[model samples]
Target: MGPIRPTIADVARAAGVSRTTVSHALNGIGKVDPRTRERVVQAAAELGYRPSLRAQRLRSGQSRTIGLVSSMPVAVAGGPSKLGFFMEVAAAAAETAMLSGFALVVVPPLDTDPPLDALDIDGAIVIEPDQDDPTTKRLQSRGVPIVTIGPQQGMDLPHVDLRAPRVGRLLLEHLREQGARRIALLMGSGHRSWYVDLAEVYARFAREHDMPPLVVEADESGGEETGREACAELLEKHPDVDAICAAVDAFALGAVRAVAERGLRIPDDVRVATRYDGVRARTSTPTLTAVDLNLAQAAASAVELLLANLKGTEVPQVISNPDPRLVVRESTRRG
Candidate 1:
């Protein structure tokens, strides 16, 4: 090496400040006087000091890395159509993390116990955690800062989630407005909180309207095939069913195929809607009437909340209730 690189200590000495003050000013971690911070920054720039990521992590006790964990197991499947919504959320989170100077790692769900110790993450963003999930439990036990995409069962962690119940109600009301007297719900077998909310709302709305509650369960993890099979079964059993509300776009796409195979006209013979809107919904034949979850905003909020928690700021128990936008399409438009 021709010349040794300048270090934080050298900058600190040049600025006549302690090493800790230099760190705070450079990282914007702790509170430092404005003049002192400016002096430290100017000295570091003049000295050409570039702090090492590893050394800063060691000093701050933070890995400067966050993890994106999902209970859905969508990443391993390589099925982009089935995981469009989640993939978008992950993409947004990754972009936000990068801008905030944090590296984002996607962690697969553990079949066995979660190896929390093996992950060198400062915190995690869990997507749609279920009740009593081992991963969530392990992270909680370790005192890890966690932000969930949806409300976690029995945990009061900060969460950024779409209003599932409201979305369900909106879909139901729209179907009824379109002259659908017999509406059926297609849902996943998993008991995630969002699923529960959707199911409960659908049932309650049906009861309130004096309509028969028809609910069908499908292998949510099985993607489009399961959705198609579930829709076929629903139609075969209830030929009078005029509307179908699927919890995901994959399921809605399946329903569209099922309807076409049955020689039924969309929005006339049958109407279809999905709770989660994604690329599949927008590109499907007749397109899909679905709810836009505003995944980008939710991802950004989750990253911001996690960053705040990491900075030792007191974050209130956040249950973000963002308004869901209903996108109308040919599938649900009558007249």
Candidate 2:
């Protein structure tokens, strides 16, 4: 059987305080004596008392929770690659918000119905905004303070752009430092703003630096197989290509596997680097070298931006831009 739910009266009796004092202490409402409040809190903690979120919402008419709506899949079935980028961003956002006395409730897809009907969130942070994404528009219409993690075309709202071009330059500079004159880019295929920005950056950088602009399509054969095929093809075409820079870490992992299968040494045979350093980068055989996009920072910035908007506070035109720092691992280091 489950443990009994403790009530406000129980806490009040235990603390020798009035039920009203216990209520005010637990909910963080108007003036209650600090000493009494602390005693009440101790009693509640000892009893493992969980305040009813629904009753609190009804009484205060404001939910203390923020919502996160993701457009990416959260899990994969028996696949080497794990959840997509948005999951990481959501987790980071939740962590920061909870630390600041806010609760984060992640809303999964309804598929048939819109998610708005089911939630009473104070504000929302939408991850990876597309040009035609309706969720942003709908939320804006409802006067919900919404922030986007990725690019949102023509929207005059605060956002965080990952600055993909700068990321490409970082990779190129690393390769150049490792004595690799010939380099290729393995990038995501879909025409999302992030990938588009990455391609433009790779092309512009490669030309200015006089490096070969070899591009590989990120096919949907899953990240591993796609990496194997693309890496093999690039190596065969440009045997002199000493480095491969991938925008997605999943693809980078694929490239690493391909390099291993070819009986080639990393950095010496063909150096590999990527963006989106998550589980795969940390756990890969050689430990991938990647640009840590600072997803947690992005999440905090996005939430604070929305909170400012909700409070009628003047917010800057942009909340956060990608300040990517490169994480060097064995994948790009030469022995």
Candidate 3:
């Protein structure tokens, strides 16, 4: 019905080289001479030749493929989860995997068992697993070499995470230095490592300071709405609150709006700070102060660690990124 497409054999013949040589040149595999590779490429172009990706994948199997999965659901049409942090992490991980010469397939969170066999993956990087995660269980049962982006409470696995205690201290200290007397925290009710570690540090800080801790926990996934409600509740209970440290950027941004709705000026009436230097934090009114967790670096590290695990080489059980810097902005500063 249509013109017969050219094949590798045709390109090889036209280039006056073996099929193996053509494969090497096309795939950028082994050491092929620069001139020879050029010639082969030219031949393929002239002959309108294309190699079958399916065939190449069948031959390589899981040897050249890896998987990236999230414990949270990602939009089917888009790769990112509800949280922008996860989206940034996934993008960084994909780039790292490409540079490492491996194909990465992102699998969305599902309640049923993942189709691991059908996926053809040698190893996997879990974005952030829960304390009792079924996906983690399935991967472990299948003996998949696994690494995690965020650490968990119970599961022991290779992971890369921020030092939350150190990060928390920096935020609190910044607020206090700005003359905040009664500070409150707005956070998620989740038990993920990030939230858990922050809560621990907050508790310790409260005990040491001999000040009563004020924390408001809610479903942070609702982004600004959750922050608004949580901040409103906190303010109603503690009207003397002079500072707020929100763990999520959306929460911090919403807190800014909430303060304004109540005719309060940020940094003057209520200083505001949060974690994760994303668009919401940077672009919010007064631009909320936030901690730069080095999201891209952390995500890339997860891929590299997973790559090491796939190579059967021993890697450190845990890799913690150091000194997540705090980015100060108008929300926590006096004009």
Candidate 4:
């Protein structure tokens, strides 16, 4: 046979203390004198007393951990801008997990094939997963519960859809509220679907309210220069445009620069807003007004959904629709 496992009673006896004191010292609960706690720890160490994580998990019926995967495309400041948003998601998920007696393990995309067999997570949350991604398909096949952040194209995956069109509507409503009539839309390339939906929503809102459609397409050349050129061209093309709703924050910043170059003041000549609430928006010269999607809350909810599935809790095909809150700031409040 193997060596017998030491127990808390063994530790207490070795430390010449009651079991309650030993328990208190080990769990950091209630009160135990400092020296006594230290002595208990020393005794436990001497006795090779190891707390049984497995036993604890069995008793609690929880793995006490979550796995997080970010399938975000690796592009230099691309449409997703994974760093800030994904980090917020992970951090908030970790905090919520810890509160509910769990931990978070962030797994970046594997260079080789993803090995589901090697992963021992209770559940997972996939951020910005592509619909046709094989890794995601494999994970789902393994009965590992998952929640996706952005919209998935074809797969029947549970997700919290970030309504891109609503983002446009929010900005339109804000601009309208601020008495903006002529609005211009700044769109990025490759994400044609998102911008198209946004344009559709903007047009519907404008037509319903009897306003002119100001849609301008910007080529995403993966550089600030292209964004600057696009902004300048659009501004020159429509000097009387009172507001701009950009698809992303960086492009919005570029628009701000273009507006300033024309010797026109922000909000006075051109108000601007974007869908993302990020550092670029916050640090812009006139602090852009954006729709705060509350990514943290969304992440937490996704994780909870994953955990529910992991627990065999009849995971409902839930669709989380987080409303976008318009963060009113200097950029768009006056126009």
Candidate 3: residue 324 Cα off by (Å): 0.8
TM-score of each: 0.81, 0.74, 0.78, 0.69
Candidate 4 lDDT over 142-207, as tens digits, reads 776777876565667777767777778888888878877888777766533355578789889988
Q: Encode model 3's per-residue lDDT on 1-335: one tens digit a residue.
A: 98898989999999999999999999999999999999999999998888986797788655577888876532211222344666677788889999999888877545455676677677888876757666667877888888887786688889997777888999988998898878898887667787788888888887877768999986744667777888988887789999999987777877888898888899899999998787677778898899888888888888889888877778887888767998999999897
lDDT of candidates 1 onward, in order: 0.84, 0.76, 0.81, 0.75
The CA-based lDDT of model 4 is what? 0.75
Give per-residue lDDT, candidate 2, residue 261: 80
Residue 265, candidate 2: alpha-carbon lDDT: 90
**Which candidate number has the best lDDT?**
1
By TM-score, the best candidate is 1
Clash pairs for candidate 4: none
Give the distance in Å from residue 20's predicted Cα in candidate 1 to where it truly belongs. 15
| lDDT for position 266 in model 4 | 84
* Model 4 RMSD, rounded to 1 decimal: 8.0
Q: In model 3, how large is the Cα lDDT of residue 121?
A: 78
lDDT of 2 by residue, 1-335 (tens): 98778888888899998888888888798899899889999999998887887887888766777888764322211144434466677778888778777788876543343567567777888776556667778777876778777767667667777776787778778887988788888876665566678788888878888876888886633656676788888887778888888866767878988888888999778898887787877888888888888888888887777677767798784765657888998888988
In candidate 2, position 273 carries an lDDT of 85
Model 1: per-residue Cα lDDT at residue 226? 88
Off by over 4 Å in 1: 1-51, 75-78, 81-83, 108-117
Better of 1 and 4 by TM-score: 1
